[model samples]
Target: MKLPESQVAALNAASATDETPIDRLAEEAGLKPETATQAVFELRDEGLLEVTERESVEYELTDEGAEYVESGLPEVRLYRTAVEAGTDDAPAQMGRIIGASGLEGPEIDIALANFGRKGYGDIDSGELSADPDADADDDPEAAALAALAEGGAVDDVDADVLDQLVSRNLLDRHERVVRTITLTDAGVTALMEGIETAETVDRLTPEMLTSGEWQDVEFTEYNVEADAPEVRGGKTHVLRQTAERVKDVLVGMGFQEMEGPHADADFWINDCLFMPQDHPARTHWDRFALDVPPIEHLPEDLVDRVESAHREGVGEDGDGYHSPWSEDFARAVALRGHTTSLSMRYLSGTEVGELEPPQRYFSVEKVYRNDTLDATHLLEFFQIEGWVMAENLSVRDLMGTFVEFYEQFGITDIQFKPHYNPYTEPSFELFGKHPTTGELIEIGNSGMFRDEVLEPLGVEHDVMAWGLALERLAMLTTGAEDIRDLHGTLADLDFLRGAEVTY
Candidate 1:
């Protein structure tokens, strides 16, 4: 059978029974000296020939291989040389010969022996056979086909089987230089036509075209090219929509609307409402007090009652809880933290009369707080506040107002827990179902008009006041993931942008 080129060349390098240097042998054989010497050792071990250690090792094929070499036709080599010379059918022809099917183990073995004799498929160790344990059962031919698919025979081939295949005219055994991988003209055409293999080409057929399913789907071969439907238009933020809905409800309910300056002096905001000058809620952390101040002038008449209430409570012998009132504190400009400040302005001025003796009023305004912002806290937000006052209104009226307001928002799960605000006695805090977090969250705080503050304003009986935090309600309504979006900053106002106002 055909010997490895290195083995033949090494034998040629050794001359006349005298030692020829292994390095020189390697040079003649186009191999490293270590490779040449190792080939010599292999030939001797296979009983091809033996050379003394004192003399250099020489090599030759064994008797069986010699007999194979003489019998295999020279045309066998001529067929391979002619095929290799013709590039047109080389790859396909090579593929067929390499993956010869129906050759059982022993016949395939005989073919391998004949291949070596013909000098057609002789490759290096890293050329044909796959891993070390490759067997006929393992389908080395299929593995070689895969290797050719990726590129010329890969580095993962085994030396012995690769040499046999290359000798058999399957793989082109060009081992003098590194094999290169470049897309061939045929390969490029195949790729453009979306064909890689039988399986891939099978996917394109007249039956597939007849169904016209491709017409229903967008074909973005390179980039996403499906045109999206044109977005409609802009909208108000959900919180703003909520505030608007609250206002709509109040107005629809015949409650006259009222508003005051956003930067109202604390006097109009708090002192007018009989908040004791010493109340803890007035502290710095909870409230955003204006740094710049002359505490704007309190209403002359309201000031008299507010001041008197500070010294000796409101009416005769009331709670007797009075603290010195400060013109400075009352006039400091602040970010309004509660819509109730507008309510105070209503009670302290001509709006009080505009509301008949039995009157209702409401406001949906932004409020600011100074608390640490968290999942449920924001320095700025909205408040839905409302009140109805008449002779002898009771806690029942407060309940009615709360239920009505929440129902308007489609909120059914709400609990009015007993709470106390310094300005309201018998106060209750509103809590409602959180839409996403699924926890009960506080909405706002409200309570009846206390005798202490109302008497000073001159309405002595009970009046209902109720307020709910706007973000909590807005979150419930809009399924917002974060509270920051409520303040008009996180993203565009989706509420107004796409809202059909219900209230």
Candidate 2:
């Protein structure tokens, strides 16, 4: 049988010894620990070696612990400095003692606190004196640090001093699994028969084949399950992929994409939607407003019509809000909280040419909200906004559109809850059952536009609109419990690496 050079070397070393730890064997053979581990496992898989593991503790020096190795322990430095300065007779000034010890900042504080607590020194009224009889050579912590400058097994060090050093953050404790490797009876027999150590080519070259020499050479056996090097290639982010899929789905259903600024005038976002200026949702705490570049170029005629709709309700028997209205507030710019602003702009023919009846528009874009981030919420996320401007549309049409849109993602289970929106009359919140949990989770908001909203947009036809959470849809489709796993800096890379892109 052919084996890797590392495995062949390790087996040879084990043939001479009864049993050896994998780490010690790696060191003696000049092989990397990880390489040794991989070879040992392969050998064990072939029944040529037997391995056993036991828990072992080890120590590594902390920043302060390493420093103490180069410059004695803090207490030892304090004691040495004070002794040289004549202690117990005339006390040295605290500053002078510290300066003479060559300690600074946190080190000065550490030395002073530890010196007095360890009975190595006495501090009185800013003057310091060392215990004249105390010896600096008996520092157990210093001795421990010196011995462990290079890490060692826990049992080999003083347990009391190790604990003290750990508590002081001078050393870090780690538990390790040490593997003991020994050759099996079969391994001995195989070595006795003959073990090949010379390098063997894994593949035959064209030159060797042409020379008719490949038949005389031995090629290494290939283990398909062996670990391979990682390769990373360029690809769109998972969230971006979801957004593109959304656009594709909408376009396939005869919807034109709407593109606009992330920072837009409130006129298109709320005023055109017939939301009153004094609405609680318009508060500064809820929306982020821009300071520079005030929005001053809104179409005057459309603004006037929207203002009238807000001041006095549209159509017969409709009463308008007698509350105050301001042109400046509507003209001010802010980060849009929803892509419904895009839908409003499109439905009103402000973004595109005058819209005829039987029109459909959609936008998959980012929106901002002043929100606290959690597992399900973020300060910013993509909104899948869509609108259908057709004659005599109803809540049923809205529900049907949602069902058809979600069905493309293999989501057949859907339920609607009666919901309220200022712009849409007879609103409903759409929900889908999670594939994993089977729990109904709200996914989007939809309703037919009210006359108060459509009249200001010059749209006499019924318009159905909905704003769905793109991240939530990604979570549902990807079987992700937390929205962060689908969208955020902390998104799980392993999940993304293995996640299958499905329609």
- Superposed by TM-score, candidate 1 places the C-alpha of residue 206 at a distance from the truth, in angstroms, of 39
lDDT of 2 by residue, 1-503 (tens): 55668888888777435679988888876788767777778888899999888998778898878988998877788888899899856787776888888887667656765686578878765578888777779777787888788554456667888877876678787766778898999898888888776566767899998999898876655555644445768777777887888888999999998899999998887888888889877765467789867798888988898899898889997788888889988988999989988887777777777889899888888998755445566668888999999988888888888888888888888888998888988998978877778777788898888999888778888899999998888878888777756644345665776765466
Candidate 1: residue 177 lDDT (0-100):
18
- Candidates' C-alpha lDDT: 0.57, 0.80
Residues 8-126 of candidate 1: C-alpha lDDT, one tens digit per residue: 45554555444545555568668875556565554444444344433222122333333334443222332343344442233233224434433343333344334333343432221
Which stretches of model 2 miss by more than 4 angstroms?
Answer: 1-8, 15-48, 51-180, 184-200, 229-236
| TM-score (C-alpha) between model 2 and the true structure | 0.68
* Candidate 1: residue 426 lDDT (0-100): 79
TM for every model, in the order presented, reads 0.52, 0.68
